[model samples]
Target: MKLRDLGGVVLAVLLLAGCSTSPVTEGQAKAISSDRVYAPDLVGRADSESAKATFLRDEGYFGSGCSHVIYVNNRKAFAIRQGEGVSLRLQPGEYSFRLETGAGMCPNIATSQDITLKPGSAVTYRILLPSDGNLRLTRIQ
Candidate 1:
């Protein structure tokens, strides 16, 4: 291959190598927690007073009443709630949170939103209900 072509190939490989899902370095993880507040909005039946909040840990779902979510840093998932706000400490990176709502009479109502968190940053999102009873995600910060 031509020298220029070979160099281009090497550069491409390096760029792709930088894209990985491994947890951030220890220093980076610590920095992330201090830098940002990862708060997502929780909108629900408008009558749900359980303060139910759900988040994804290394194991699995940590709480109940979590229907919708926002992925943060590819490492954590924040669940949507109603009224009351939810909070969590997570490593820095990119995430996608899937928003959901109640079932049965409220089954058909659901919505989701995406958010990206940087190291040492706080993200505040919103959960709201449409007039028709469907749910929608709103980012506050």
Candidate 2:
């Protein structure tokens, strides 16, 4: 793609990115990710609250340019670039987590994993970026 074309695609992606609420917070992302974070909308509870689950994206530079979006229960929860991570505070339940590429110019790639969250327990999921074509979401903590 040419320079202007790539710029248009990035602009379009930025505009479309704000349409949803991300479960991850900017503060948490900054603390974990070694790269950059695109999705930072807070959709989870506070640290003082009774948090049941936490989702973190792996810190890597393989897919740094594309927005690595994390989907929880089939919804867009957050987008973490290479080296970026998110800590989410969620309620107790069974949640399906997945990874996807950002809209426009990004590859249509994805991977998913399921976990059951219990009360007074903290569950964690991790998204590993290996390439622009696909990503893996696995339980790490």
Q: List the residue pairs that clash in candidate 2.
A: 33-83, 33-84, 34-83, 60-83
Task: TM-score for candidate 1, please give it.
Answer: 0.42
lDDT tens digits, residues 32-98, model 1?
A: 1221234422222222222222232111112223344344334334443333334554444445666
Per-prediction count of colliding residue pairs?
A: 30, 4
Error of 2 at 14 (Å): 32
Off by over 4 Å in 2: 1-42, 46-50, 102-106, 131-134
- Under the 3 Å rule for N, CA and C atoms, how many clashes does model 2 have? 4
